[model samples]
Target: MTSLLFVDDETKLLRILSSYFTKKGFVVHTASTGEEARSKLRDADARIIFLDLRLSDATGIELLQEFVPRYPNKLFVIMTAYSDVESAVTAMKAGAFDYVSKPAKMDELEIIIRRACEWLDMKQENRTLKEKISKMMQDQEMIGVSPAMKRVFRMVERAAETDATVLLEGESGTGKSRIARMIHRWSDRKNQPFVSVNCAALPEQLLESELFGYEKGAFTGAHAKRKGKFEAARNGTIFLDEIGEISLPLQAKLLQVVQEKSFMPLGSNQTVHVDVRIIAATNRDLKTMVEEGLFREDLYYRLNIIDIFIPPLRERKEDIPPLIEQFLDKQRAKYNKPFTLPPELIDRLVEYPWPGNVRELENAVERAVVLCRDEQLSIEDFPREIRHAKPDRPPSDIALDPTKSLPEQLESIEKKLILDALEQTGGQIAAAARLLSISRQRLMYKMNKYSIR
Candidate 1:
C-alpha cells in the first residue's frame, strides 16, 4: 500500500483532506505544523507529500526545498491560496511535483494525486530496468565452443536448475561474473531482482551496513532506516562478486545468512528473514586462502556447492573467432556504423595472445571499429602492437636459388610462412593456423609431415 502525508496548519483542512484520502484507500498521515510534519516523515515511508504554503510557523516553499533533496524519490505537491501564485511557482522550481490553489476542487486534487502516484511508479520501474540492463551489459555471455567451455556450459545448465549457491572460480578477466549472471538468467528466479555487490569496493564498516541495513538512529547521520540489498532482492538472487575480498568476520556473517536465510540490521535487535540466493565469483584461489586462514573453510564449502570455472582466453583460442564477431556486432550497433571485419583481420586477431582475455579482445574490437573508415576493416585498423607483428625471417629466404622446381619453391615458401606464424604466435598451433589461412586440423597435419615444432 502507498503512503501519503498531508501537512496543513488549518485544523479543519487537515482533518477533511486526511479523511477524504483515507476513504480513497490511501494510508494517509496528517500533521498540523511543519515541525509535526517533519517528525511524522521520519517514521513514515510516504511516497507522496502534500504541504500547505501558508503554514503557521514556516513557509511551505522552505519545507519543500528542505525535503526534496533529502527524499528526491518522494513526490511533493504544494498548496496555496489562488493569489499566492508566485510562491507556488517558486515551489515548483524547487522540485515540487505540482502546485494547487487553496479551496481547490476535490476532482482537481484527486487528478493531481493520481498523476503523482503514477509518476512515482514509473520512476521506480525505470530504476529497476536500468539496474537490470547494467547487470546484463556487464555480464557478457560465455563465448567458447571448446571442450573446456562445453564442460563449463554443462555445469552452468545444471547449476541454473537448482537453488544451490554457485562459486565461480577463475583467473582475472576470465568472465566469472558472466557465468554467474547466466545462471541467474536461466533460473526460476529470473523474473526477480539480481542484486550484485562488490565485496572489495567498500570498507568493511560500509560494506557491513550495506549488506545488512541500519535502522534510523542506528548510527550518526543514519537519520532513516535504509533497505539493504538482501531485503531489496527478496526472493531473488544476490550476486556477491569478489566474495573472497571480504574479511573473515564478514564472511562468517554472510555464511550465516546463506545457511539461515536471515540477518539483523545494524543497531537493530530484530532479525530480518529473506529468501535470497547467493552467487559468488572470485579470481583468488579460495582453497589457498582457506589454508592461509584468510578465508573460512566452512563458508568455502557452502559456496562451492556448485563450482564453475571459466577458462582464460589464451587457453581457448578456438573461441576467439566467435567472440570477435559478437564484439564487432555490438560495437557496430553502438557506433551506428555498418562495418564488416575482413577475414584476414580476424585471422590476425585469432593469432594474438589476449592477456586481458575476452575483455581485451572486446576493447581491441571497439578500438578497431572506431579507427575504421571503410566498411571492411583491415589489419591497419588494429592497434600498433598488433599491426606491426612480423615473424623472424628464416635463413632459407636468403639462400634459396631462383632455379628450384615450382612445387618445391612453393613448399619452401609455405614452410617458411608457417614457421614464421608459429614463431610470431609463441608456438600456439591454432593461432599459427589462423595466420596461415588454414584450419587448425590441416595445419596440424602439415606440421606433423614437415616436422615443424
Candidate 2:
C-alpha cells in the first residue's frame, strides 16, 4: 500500500484525514505540530506528505524547503484554507507538488495522489533511460594515448569551451563525425538537440530543404510546412558531414548562414534566424579545393576558424592496443563472454597499416569476438583483408641486422624503401613521392637527410 503523512495543527482535522486515508487502504501517519511533523517525517516511511500551509510553530514553505532538497524522491502537497490559495500557489512554486484547499474533497485528494504517482513513475523511467545512454557513451568514449590523439583531445576541449565553427578534416573512418558529437556533448548546449546532416547523402534541392525548412507549397511535393535542421537544432549544434560534397550554389547559401546566422528557406522570402553551433567534417582537403576554384574560398575560410585534423590510425599505431581493448570490452559486455587475444596478434595488428583506420579495426575486433567459440580470438577470425595484410615494407627488402639499435634499423628500412621507390620511378621526384604517398617536399627533405644523390 502507498504510505502518506498528513501534517495539520488541528488535532481533529489530522485525526479525520488519518482515519479516512487509513480506511482507504493507505498506510497513514499524522502529526499535530510542525515539530511533531518533522519528527514523524524522519521516522515514518511515506511517499507523500500533506503539509498545512500555516502550521502552529512553522510555515509550510519553511518545512517544505527543508524537506524537498533532503528527500527529493518524496512528494509534498500543500493543504491550505480557500482564502490562503495565493500562499498555496507560493508553496507550489517552493517545491510542493500540488495544493489542496481546506474542506478537502475525498475525490480531489485521490486525483492529486494519482497524478503524483504517475509523475514519479515517469521520472523513474526517464532516469533509467538516461543511465543507459550514459553507459553507452562511456563505453564508446575516444580511446587514445598517442601524442597525435592527445593533441586532438586538447583541441576538442578548447573547442567545447566555445561556440566557434569547427571544421574536422581527416580521411574516411577516422571518426570525424564522432569528434563532432564529442564537441557537442561537452559544450554548454549539451542538453539541447544535436542535429546531423550528411550533405552528400542528399541532392542539392533536397539537401537545401532539409537544412532550412520549406513553407507550404514552396516545392513540388510540399504538402505542408516543415522545420529544417537549423530550426530543429536551435540553440544547439548542427554537424554537416561530407561538407565538401555540397554544391557551389548550396555552398553560397550555407556561407550566408555561417556568416549571418540566418538563412532563407527554399522558395521562401522570409528568413529564419537560428542560434546554432556549426561543426563541419570532410575527408577532402578544402584548402586544395579552394585553390583549384572548386570550393568557395570565403566559405572555406569561415569553417576553418577552428580547424582540427584527426590523424589516421596508421600514424598513431601506439593507440592501437588501447583501441583494441576498448572494442573488446564492449563486445565482451554485449556477448557476455571472455575473449582473449594472443600477444602476437597484437604485434601483427600494430604493424599492419589500417587503411580504413579505427572503424576497420573495431569491425575486425567485433567480427572476431562474435565468431570465436573457443573464447580465444585469432587472426583467422578477422576479415581476409586484415589477416593477409603485410607491413608497408618487408624485412627482407631492408636486410635488417639484429645488432643495430631499433632506430637505426628503422632508418635503414625507410632509406631502402625510398631508394626502391626512386629506382622504380626512374629517379623522377614527383612520381617517387606519389608512390611513397608522401608530399614532394617531404620526399625531398628525406633525400637530403639521407644524402641520396
Q: Whose lDDT is greatest here?
A: 2
What's the TM-score of each model vs. the native? 0.56, 0.58
Off by over 4 Å in 1: 1-140, 384-453
Report, for every candidate in turn, its global Cα lDDT versus the true structure: 0.83, 0.87
TM-score for candidate 2: 0.58
Candidate 1, position 368, lDDT: 81
Q: Mind giving the per-residue lDDT tens digits that candidate 2 earns over 190-221?
A: 99999999999998999999999899999789
Q: How many steric clashes does model 1 contain?
A: 0
Candidate 2 pairs with clashing backbones = none
Q: In model 2, which regions exceed 4 Å deviation?
A: 1-139, 393-453
* Alpha carbon lDDT at 104, candidate 1: 76
The superposed Cα distance between candidate 1 and the true structure at residue 134, in angstroms, equals 22
